[model samples]
Target chain A: MSTIDVNGTAVEVDEEGYLVDLGSWTPEIGTALAKGDDCELTDNHWEVINFLREYYEEYQIAPAVRVLTKAIGKKLGKDKGNSKYLYELFPYGPAKQACKYAGLPKPTGCV
Target chain B: MSDVKKFLYVNRKQPYGTIYALESLEVVLIGAAFEQDVSLAFVDDGVYQLTKGQDPSGIGMKNFSPTYTALGDYDINKIYVEKESLEARGLTIDDLQHLTWEDEDEDWAEKDSIRVVSASEMAEIMDQQDIVLSF
Candidate 1:
């Protein structure tokens, strides 16, 4: 059994290393996740975080990078949906970081 | 505002031609900064984004595929590819670089971490998103 202290709260990890109670997550918890992981959330981080939360609600899952690009292009206009713009903002992994900030469970199958 | 929001970025364009692919990446990156939850679905020609070994130098374009590797730094890891799209395009997980396989020696399966679904499944995902941005 592995345990992670999130925002001073001890969270027990299951055998699979997933959170036992995913619902207990919150934005504050996400902030903690970023901090614990040493990721810095910049002004641009908000757009993807908000987008992921809404995306999860509709599909109950996180969108992969390719799909994310196309979707953003359609809604926010084509200019803001390309990979170059996305890399500039997240510079890491938009889906992973955004999911964490959205308080959603870590996306399955990510390394 | 209006509580946390959800967005679905639908990628449908080719890797080059237009700026659609790059623009979509920006929204997801910025959207995450805003604390929004984001997911992505690739359909039609959009599947090309996941293809591997792309050398854009001949066209005088930078190699954009490498940027996909940076998604983890930002924590945006959710990635999906339509199974049918892969088949239709004669693409397999092996054709793509970043994706992992269960067998590591075989084709992508349903159990693969990437959500490879049908057109209808993609549509369902779109309808559920608070905002569906297509490129």
Candidate 2:
């Protein structure tokens, strides 16, 4: 089984490897994670983060990178969909880093 | 450090074209690996991620949707879909695999416990979440 420590919180992994306690998260925790990564939360970051939260509430799963970009494009307009723009905001990788900062689990199929 | 936190993922794009879906899933899995609570929501064309019968081999890309099944391995359950999104895309609950469906007709009085919701309702969910990330 795999496990990770978030803000010193030791979380257990399930059989499929996902976390079991989603109700415990808070925005402040997400901000702390982003700060640890040297990222400054901005309005743009909030846009993506807010979007992901809503998405998860409805679907209960994470979106892959491809879907994330297209959705960003559609919602924020095409100018924001391009990889260049997304990468600029999340240098460590938009989908990966942003989801982490948002306090969500790591996305699937990532190395 | 005290406890794992809830993290929401919003998917709104198509299945292919970029690394949005793939990368987002990676983050979700990683979060789960760390013991954080994670959930996913599909809206707009993002719903395509759950569509059945995908064939990415022709395009030279791996069939990424298969990763959806792997999500359970990470314990990152709690997948959701927007009712309007499914209807707009002409997809039904049967078209999707490996997820719990929330019909549009379900109760929404509590707001937080709702599964299927309208676009606006989905937005409201985002607002209430401590952290929201859109992929």
Candidate 3:
């Protein structure tokens, strides 16, 4: 039962600060969520965020870390393909943290 | 609650009828990274999870039973099976895959992975665990 104000409008978020309503998500909401975690979103971070959002829209499920790493590698290049690189971009966990920012449900199963 | 507490995951369901057994195994595998004192207990129909010669291809399911053999590689070598449950189901040790893991402390000597315990012995194990998650 936590909420964060985005552009003077109160929006509901979950315990982990992920937006409760998927329809309520916006660029500002993403920025605010990242700021709450003391993370300033860089272009590289946004790249992953956008990728995850697109991936979810198509698959109806958030990609796990391994899947995300491979997809990123294919689209971005092998230089950014492995989990080690993704972990550096999202320190908490690429599959989890990035999905939260992307406004997707938490990935299930073994991540 | 202290981090890395003794955890006993009790499995009592069949493997594929529902996702419980697979999901529980997933959590156990995930929990291993924490290096906690983890023990897995199989009772009731859950004993079928370790049965050999499983071919789920007829059901269009990819057989994940082989993952049980790899559990030891993940340092999850402690598995307990309820003796009565298997006996009631007409299953014996010969019907189970003989899984073994190398003991790092024993200079990589291979050791049996599963231990058959009586109902009373399993109760003692459950009593000793700090956290018990049954599926």
Candidate 4:
């Protein structure tokens, strides 16, 4: 486990940079974490982060890329629903990186 | 730690019933990061892992089978789907996902990822591996 400073408050993050305790998450922490990954939090990124957080709250797990893409397509417009666009926003992976910024657990099943 | 070795991940269990199939795939993805010679062999009930149009919502499970399509991006595209196993389960190549990858060395030509092989041929492949992890 490692710690990062968010508004001068130290918060623990896992080795993969996901929040150790999801309850410790905040917009400031998400911004700080995205900065560490060389990303800026645009409205597009928040759209994904918010969706992931809501999905995790409902399913108790972050979805893999396929499920995420399908759900995004059904809820958001198809224009913002494809993996290419999601990958463009996260670069690393939509499921992994976006969930990390959303303070969700690293999705375990085949991600 | 970059000592390149041949890794054969033998998957013989059915998907969804147990965690073995999904967990084995997790190892495959991590193994990809090591840049080793990785090949996956689907034998016995494991052939169901790649069956297309799997909807797990009725059982309250998330379908992660599509992750197999991205294996090529990790440079782990050599997959042997045993014909005997599929036949035993009354299936054919058409029942599975059409997985493909681009061959950059060959003018970016699209190539199939799954190769159907006989059980005996798979035995020969298993014999050639340096490290075999069967699930």
Candidate No. with top TM-score: 4
Candidate 1 local lDDT, residue A12: 62
lDDT tens digits, residues B1-135, model 1?
777667778898888888899778766655665566667788888889878888888999756665555454344545677778888888887887664223313431322335677878777777788888888
Identify the superior model by lDDT, candidate 2 or candidate 4.
4
Ranked by lDDT from best down, the candidates are 4, 3, 2, 1
Badly placed stretches (over 4 Å) of model 2 are A1-111, B100-115
Q: In model 1 chain B, which range of ten residues has the least summed lDDT? A: B101-110
lDDT of 1: 0.67
Question: Number of clashing residue pairs in every model?
Answer: 82, 64, 0, 0
lDDT of model 4, residue A90 = 91
Candidate 2 lDDT, B1-135, residue by residue in tens: 767677899999888887898877767765665666677888988889888788888999867676676464345556778999999988887788654222224531212222566788777767766678889
B69-128 in candidate 4: lDDT tens per residue?
767655777999999999999999999988877675896588999999998999999999
Chain B superposition TM-score per model: 0.80, 0.80, 0.95, 0.95
Candidates 1 and 2: which is better by DockQ? 2
After superposition, candidate 3 runs with Cα above 4 Å error? A1-111, B1-3
Question: If both were scored by lDDT, which would come out higher, candidate 1 or candidate 3?
Answer: 3
Model 2 in CAPRI terms: which quality? Answer: incorrect
Candidate 3, A1-111: lDDT as tens digits: 999877788889988777899876798888888887889899999999999888766534565565577568868988898888889888999988988887877764434
